[model samples]
Target: MSKAIDHLMKVHRPKQKIQNNRLRSVIVSIYLTKFVPCGDPANANGGRWLLTFGSPDMKLDDLWQETLLGMIGDCFSHDSDPQPLSRFITGCVVSIRVRGHKMGLWLSEAQNPNIVREIGRRWKSMMNLPSTIRIQFETHNESGSAQQKPIYEE
Candidate 1:
């Protein structure tokens, strides 16, 4: 990807103009999911388990890769559940920001605290996060709204 970016930059750097806002960055998002709309019965409610980093951490890349693999690779399954816990996962996102970086695990249900919290706990363990870092689960209903708040944290 870096090589491709370098090639693109080499080709466009000479013609670079402020008017065109293209090919400015690397990867934007990695969304993993099966088809299911907002109205789908399979997803009655939805939320995201959010983990924020103060600055770009050395482990960010590995954590993101691990999280991506855990979700799509069925690493969340255990003895307690009949199905893989990842079944409830709708998608995952990692956002790069100036203030902090955020890793989100979007889920199919937010109304159920049991599984939601369980996922949060497992997520912390998966990332091997220190206790100092807290991961919060915020319902989609609350995201970017006045009511935006985390219902669960680990």
Candidate 2:
């Protein structure tokens, strides 16, 4: 009976392609931070804030570029709807503030977000998490910014 069960299991095993897809679909939580200029010289030369999102199944680097391009598209002029920034947003300099993790690419004013809300909304959707994901866009400004300054620290 044990031999028969083993044979049945082997016969029912899935192929490699099926296994790969299943693996790829598995949800993976990744922490991502997007920095946008806030238009303040004291806070910095440009107006910007740091927005953080938790994503699943998306690569960190790819998501970073996507988030940047999405923000830039929302603010500046893009040739097309999808926009050309999709390619340019990648391979830019990013400075990550998280401890023990010296990661990120620094995107220029042409790359960072002029509109913070658009970026925040996009980030939340990209995460694709089943649960309600909280995305916060934080900048160092007293008032008149697109979004409010984050009171709670990550």
Candidate 3:
């Protein structure tokens, strides 16, 4: 997406709404319809969303920008893996819910733990989070289903 489109679509949350911290129904609908696809892990796992819960002290947009900037930088990093997995990161989302805030990095697959972990590590580094900070990987199938739990986490 273009920066103009991104800026237009990017959420600008208010203080009150941030304090509420509830994932709005509109956002959920958008994720379900626009991002998450329908199918099996092998066929549809082409993309994954790396989800990280933000610290209570951090603002949603700040975390989003940090993680996003990190992803963007990695995309152009010079010292790189011969077969890079970061190429799969298509975009990101910063969500505020009643429980807390979350930043999701959208990837192109969920089957490879190596790629997933690498992405998670990059995300943690970018956000300046600790190693223990949990990052969850959820496939479109798992995310779309009401009963299934997330596919993986690191």
Candidate 4:
């Protein structure tokens, strides 16, 4: 009876470890998805827009650049009006959360124009904001009409 109990414990230990690892992986994946802005708006007004990339391993600025380029590409393909896209996206606030190996992003309306315009211009889309609004970036790079900057301030 003692020998049988020992064998069962040994078998269960490995299975438990595997289950724990799997759970950790799932948690990490969920975190990553949250960091990226991938979801439908609550009002069902516009199509899904995923702008933020939620991993600490990934740079938010670079992800913004890529997202802008991708959106521009999409616009080019669909030939949609750039003005409305600029207005809608500029008014959005994206929240990205990343901890250790996990990340997540959430998007909603933003009251600040600086935040909106900074993110909007990355897509080469223009925004009209009040003159009282102030915009700042830690790093700014411009190549032709393409501009890039970090979305979050350090």
Which one wins on lDDT? 1
Scored against the true structure, residue 144 in model 3 reaches a CA lDDT of 52
TM-score for each candidate, following the candidate numbering: 0.74, 0.32, 0.64, 0.22
Q: In terms of TM-score, which candidate is strongest?
A: 1
User: How many clashes does each candidate structure show, in the order listed?
Assistant: 0, 12, 4, 6
lDDT of 3 at 34: 37
- The whole-model lDDT of each prediction reads 0.69, 0.34, 0.56, 0.31
The model with the greater lDDT, 2 or 3, is: 3
Between prediction 1 and prediction 4, which has the larger TM-score?
1
lDDT of 4 by residue, 81-137 (tens): 443433333112233332332112222323344444444444323222233332332
CA lDDT, candidate 3, residue 149: 67
Residues 1-154, candidate 2: write the lDDT tens digits: 5563454334311223235565332222112134333332322422222333333232444544444444444333245545533332222222332221112222222224533344334344653423443543333343245666643221
lDDT of 1 at 128: 91
Query: Could you give candidate 3's per-residue lDDT for residues 1-154 as a string of tens digits?
Result: 3674475346454334444665242132122123433443333665454554555665555656565555645542336665665566656665556566556676666778777667766666667766677777777656656785666666
Residue-level lDDT of model 1, residues 68-142, one tens digit each, is 667656677787786678888877766654456677888888987888888889988998998989999887766
Which runs in model 2 stand beyond 4 Å of their true positions?
Answer: 1-49, 52-58, 72-94, 97-119, 127-132, 142-154
